[model samples]
Target: MEEHCLFYLAALAIFILMLVMTFFISSLLQTPPRRHKTASLPLPPGLQPLSVLGTFFALFRRSEFDVEPLLRRLHSRHGPVVSFRLLSFPRPPIFVSDRVLAHRALVGRGATFADRPSAIDPGLIISSNRHNVTGAPYGPVWRALRRNLATKVLHPSQLRVYSPARRQVLDVLLKDLETKSSGGAAAVVVMESFRFAVFSLLAFMCFGERLDDEKIRRIASLQRELLSNFVSFSVFAVYPKITKLLFRSRWKKLLDFRSKQEETYVPLIDARRNLLLRRQRSEDGFVYSYVDSLVDLEIPEDGGRKLKDGEIVSLCSEFLSAGTDTTATALQWIMANLVKRPDIQTKLYEEIERVVEKDAVVREEDLQWMPYLKAVVLEGLRRHPPGHFVLPHTVTEEVEFEGYRIPKGAVVTFSVAEIGWDGAVWTEPMEFRPERFLEGGEGEGVDITGVQEIRMMPFGVGRRICPAMGLALLHLEYFVANLVKEFEWMPAADGEEIDLTEKVEFTVVMKTPLKARIVPRKRT
Candidate 1:
């Protein structure tokens, strides 16, 4: 009886200790008490101060598509620069709409704002611990990856080498469109075809092999699934530990998606590796691919360790994804505009006829001679920039910009849509007029790169400007010229108009996908 009493007392003591520990941990996990705003440097006006719970609910109330419009309204009301914080997000991103100030933040003092946000999000789950270039921390590793991408994948010379591959993909795309749009008058959705074409092109460049239509379609489907989930809040992004402990279902779904990605990507990576081995052994002339270049690349930061298979897979995924979605979405938007404005389409077609040979494929080299084509693409990018906000940038050190003090560790993103359509920069910015880029026009001699000054930055500017800008332009220009050259794009039957309403997923795309009645244009 005495021993039993002692055992009960020890058990009770242990239970009480565990309860205290649990309470302490819960308090720590809950949002910390809000920090008072700096007295000297006030954040730009937006979002009234609210408690953590209040802020989370209020901030997330707007859908992702609505977020940009809301910001634009705020910018008009509260000057060009605006800052807001959410209880859930540790650092609030300051949205900059003023062109000169944006240039200063992104280019003039770029290194200060060069780092990507250190967010624990689902989007980064497959980034090979941020080994790939896009999300890698600004350092030696990033430099090495960027250098490799610039030299091996995105260089002008490398693009020249890939011209044949581009032509082949374009041919495949044309054939697919012809078959799909064969039904008379009734329009078919072309977004899927565009996506397949673009994804296949990037996939070929990455893996160094052409896949069958079915296989390519399968890969595209899997990638879309992954990308959709990537942007959504998931276990990996928020409450990482709790997700594992209690949200097993969400955790399992992520794992399954990742597994599918691996299954699709790993084999392609292996095949590419084998191709490299064969090329090394044989005396045959070899063309280098993105994977081939990555295989040869040695990371100085990792003690000259060559990238592993998983890392290769990650890089290839980024390559496939970045190239596919953005270009495809842009293609749809540009084509939608063409369908909506037949006059513009007619002018574009007339220019193509003047420039190119009858019934011939559009080549990358020919793009230089065609300024109107360039302007049309420029206008498409301007009116509907793929992303409303450039990826959020973290300030490495505290710096003042245009009399506003920016604190270190703050997230900053320039408003691509706002800046593109700034009335001060472009007259009638909302109107889609490619002629604006012609000589003596508002955008004439404008520099897309913010090097001289940022007039418009659809591809972003400065140290973090997209390395693939050149390749992307080539894709857009080449495909747009060809698709217009082949087909007379018209609006769908029975008063169905092109809906320009955008919905943000992996990229901002038309809320209602463009379905166009297309007929093969007669060539003389």
Candidate 2:
């Protein structure tokens, strides 16, 4: 799912050949580094290195498609802390999954570990660079960008102000569902529908302009096409140079796409800029959305010039992307689990019914009274994180953990999905038990912040956590509350079993589109 290998293997192979040539040309011209004293760490004697490269050969042996299994193998063999070399690139990065080590990498020794390595999406580097919060490395600039997002865009007040837009989109989604259900059986590719809903809401919220279904779908499709380019799980962000060679054709296409995407963004960016200029002059009562906030503020760090159009556009791109696919994919996964468990769905519906009378559509105003609805949503995030792996964090210095050495510049990643399913961490890890989130259960309203211990980091943790998380959760809660309250969902006629196989792109997605019958709730 991550690497749609069949679609672009030939192109990737050619790129690999090209990259191999490049590597040789560069290696021959550049002088090799002089040998140094063996870097040793205080470690338990039992641990032994299989080779000078530690885990390199085995990792290199596996193809790009083998990443997950490769990670699993290293985790199993090396016990959470593993080291390997990037064949094409010069970095000898390590991967860690131990909770403590991961926390150390992300938070405890934060600054030393914060800079995100540049990946192949030159668009990401050239367009976004450090100006955009999402791709910027950790420092004064990164903090400034993130601080801006928090204060100007992601603040609670901002979320509350945009509540109407979210609820309106949820309303639209429900109405669409009603139309679809009116037909005999709804072959709800809930994934696509969910993506559309999230993107539509994000596009509206970010730009303050509601796009039609076709327009929103085209943007969503382009985002998807771009996301599918690398396909190699987590490689694009961590070991992109090597991954770039593997996905060479895609790299070129991404280059072209970056230019086109920037072009497409120009009109929207200009419209928002013009509107903001007008709103600021008029003192409109309506508070600015993210794009508006971006346009109004000067990037103090960047020569005190007004934010560049390309930079502002990149910020908006992050708003659309971070807000859309991840949340929508999570919504689909939640629905899949909810659809599979009729009892859970019934309990959720009953709770909503008690909170808001039958024939009453669930509204944001009514959410505070419906605890079960909140629990169901949390359970969904824990059960099926859209991004199974959070974007990778590279280590800045050598560190020792659990009697093992984590050399400097290792690429560290946390398994958000694995944490949710760790039996030791979550009881009945595989079961779709929303009750786990109920008042007295093991997962009783656990703070989703992931600060203390990683109960679940579905939206990620520490500095690298998704900035749009609160908005995403709000979107999920409101949408799920309405959809479940309005319909008693059932499996399609062909079979009773609810298949939940994954077909990943940017986010892990359901392979078999969730097709089901939605009998309307009893009218008043």
Candidate 3:
């Protein structure tokens, strides 16, 4: 009986495999239809002119982590726009790298191009299939969620109220740095410290309570576990029905991670809720927080339904994860650049010193006075954005740009790295020169948002632009200044140079974590 059962199970597995292969072959032989009434126009050039299945199989040979180099090569060989078809996908995703084309697609016709991919959005899973700002379809739900965050949590007034929390987190970061760099230790890994700093700050804003280091670190670890598993075009990129049936383990893993996250997040969220209720009864005021804002928001589209606890948890998790990793990764890259080039570091340090006393803490208000510091941050983001592409955008309707047709519900991504380093936009796209942003320089008055023209869109542009752009910029500026002011960052003393090579995780991070020597500044 056992032998018979084993034989039947093995045969069943073989049957499923054969069915999938047969479907793939049949799809490959069929010609795809154009979105418009016109005959099929030529797609932007890529590896080969294969049918959808062949293209997917060829692309599948490259792992999720390996897409960047492939994309770079394709953009080099092909023009600004490149297209690739996926298995069973309705349309091929078009990647745009040209500034003019990007501006045209992402900004000029923002509305038509603003919707997210309708099928199997990874964020929907991560967000518990609730109304998440990043992954929700462009509609009344997304608009309401985004507006709540924008007006209540990320507004200038709200950020101002959270300034004290930022300061407290900065103190935690400085102490950690001090402990690591003390006793003439070897170069310390900067990424870990950077992660702790940013995560701690976001946690405070999200929970409306200052968590101890241990609790915050636990949450950070779990969140990283979830994000590290989520690579672009991984299992979630496929059709949802097939993914659920065939890739059930992946879904299970995501749920397990979400479970672990809730274990850490639920208490905090409930505490905030109870506190808000208590305040309502006792008439006691409290500082604003992201969760507090979320709790109070009533969705008009959903018949004025308030957010559920699980939805709140998902939103808070997204807030913490999104804000922490990207900011931390950008901070690491910027600091690495400074360490790699001491001349730039000295110029920034001098500028910082000139603006404020040596012992003074760099305040948020003081950032504007330092042009070199601002230039350094901009240069870092330009050279190495946290992610090479923004979250994949979906077109709500058929659109035409520069003679190329974009079908409705197709995925579109813009290459941030390619555009930022385009020689046509910058004098030397590869060089790390902050002075380019000064008067009469090629990058003078450069707009990070490509509203006017997409010279370099690091944080993206148009209606779908990162809502936290202002806060992200402030975090980068504040931390970079303080770190530079606190220590004279130097390359590792053991003849090891700063490794600028990037490996994508949740963000484009240093392949070799940044470890650098630190000499405490006398003023610090």
Q: Highest TM-score among the candidates is held by which one?
A: 3
In candidate 1, which residue ranges exceed 4 Å CA deviation?
1-39, 58-65, 88-90, 234-236, 279-285
Candidate 3's C-alpha runs over 4 A off are: 1-35, 38-40, 49-65, 119-122, 236-249, 280-285
| lDDT ranking, best first | 3, 1, 2
lDDT of 2 by residue, 166-283 (tens): 7778778877776877753565555666777788878877776677778777777767766665343333552467666665675677667667777877787788778666655346
Q: What is the lDDT of residue 447 in candidate 2?
A: 72
Query: On residues 44-132, what C-alpha lDDT tens digit does candidate 1 reach at each position?
Result: 67755455434434433435335676786887788888877654244566889888888988888888889987747455557777878
Q: When superposed on Cα atoms, how far off is each prediction in RMSD?
A: 6.9, 5.3, 3.6
lDDT of 3 by residue, 1-524 (tens): 99978975675466447647866897889786644753265555665545544544453344543666777788888877888755444567888888898898888899988898764555666676757888778888889999999998899788987888888888878877878888336568878888888998888888777889889888888888877777533655544555455556777777787778778788887888888888763454456788888888887665779988778888888898889989999999999899889999999999999997888889999999988888888999999999889889988877666667677777899888888989987988888999998888888999887889888888889989999999999999999999888888887785667778888677888999888888788843
Model 3 lDDT vs. the true structure? 0.81
Error of 3 at 179 (Å): 1.1
Stretches of candidate 2 above 4 Å error? 1-38, 42-64, 88-90, 121-126, 230-252, 279-287, 300-302
Score candidate 1 by TM-score against the native.
Answer: 0.89
Q: For each candidate, how many residue pairs have backbone atoms clashing (under 3 Å)?
A: 0, 3, 0
Per-model TM values vs. the true structure: 0.89, 0.84, 0.90
Who is ahead in TM-score, 1 or 2?
1
TM-score preference between candidates 2 and 3, better one: 3
* Order of candidate numbers by TM-score, starting with the best: 3, 1, 2
